[model samples]
Target: MDKIHLKGCRFYGYHGAFVEEQTLGQIFVIDCTLLVDLEKAAQSDDLVDTVHYGLVFETIKKQVEQHKYKLIERLAGAICQDIFQEFPAVQAITIKISKQNPPINGHYDAVGIELERQRP
Candidate 1:
């Protein structure tokens, strides 16, 4: 199947176990790959025929910003579920949510969670 990819979307969210983390918030990067049939959209050249990526991005961004979750895995799962619920055209989705420059003692750039889901 064909796919539409949204890569490296950055957002600030309150999602961590630490007290300072929840109050201060941190930067999170999200990457999504949506699997769908693009032949119709390609042939017709119609925006309606394909998923509106901007809308999807906005939805994800809004949710991430508004909701406070302790784990990236939960956030990613919720996002995947929302996509499948909101858009029937999406056959499958893989999402990666990363926390950039987490507050850790050791040297590490980021930590993240990745999940893949399919519409039933």
Candidate 2:
């Protein structure tokens, strides 16, 4: 299996269990890694045979920015599902979502959740 990774995508979103968090919003960072078979694309050097990374980035951005969720778990799951649907070549996906300066009364650069899914 071959891999494609996208890291350090930052966006501001109002997602949290707390009202203050929802109203104020915070910076969220997203990372995605996907498993794919690169042999065909590598041989043909055709965009059609391979996944369009721009579209993947846009999908991740849209999923993160356009919707509200109380848990990163759900957000991550939704992203994986969307990617699987959008890119049939994606055999598996791993996504991580992080919020910097979480309201948990601790000094941390970011708090995050990571999950992986394989196509069924």
lDDT against the true structure, per candidate, is 0.90, 0.88
Best by lDDT: 1
How many clashing pairs does model 2 include? 0
Q: Give the per-residue lDDT digits (tens) of candidate 2, residues 37-64.
A: 9999999999998888889999998877
List the candidate 1 regions with Cα displacement exceeding 4 Å: none
Model 2 residue runs over 4 Å out of place are: none
- Per-candidate TM-score against the hidden true structure: 0.96, 0.95
Residue 6 in model 2: lDDT: 91
lDDT of 1 at 90: 98
Taking the tens digit of each residue's C-alpha lDDT, what string does model 1 give over 1-120?
Answer: 999999999999998888888899989999999999999999999999999999889879977999988778888888888898888999999999988767787877788888989897
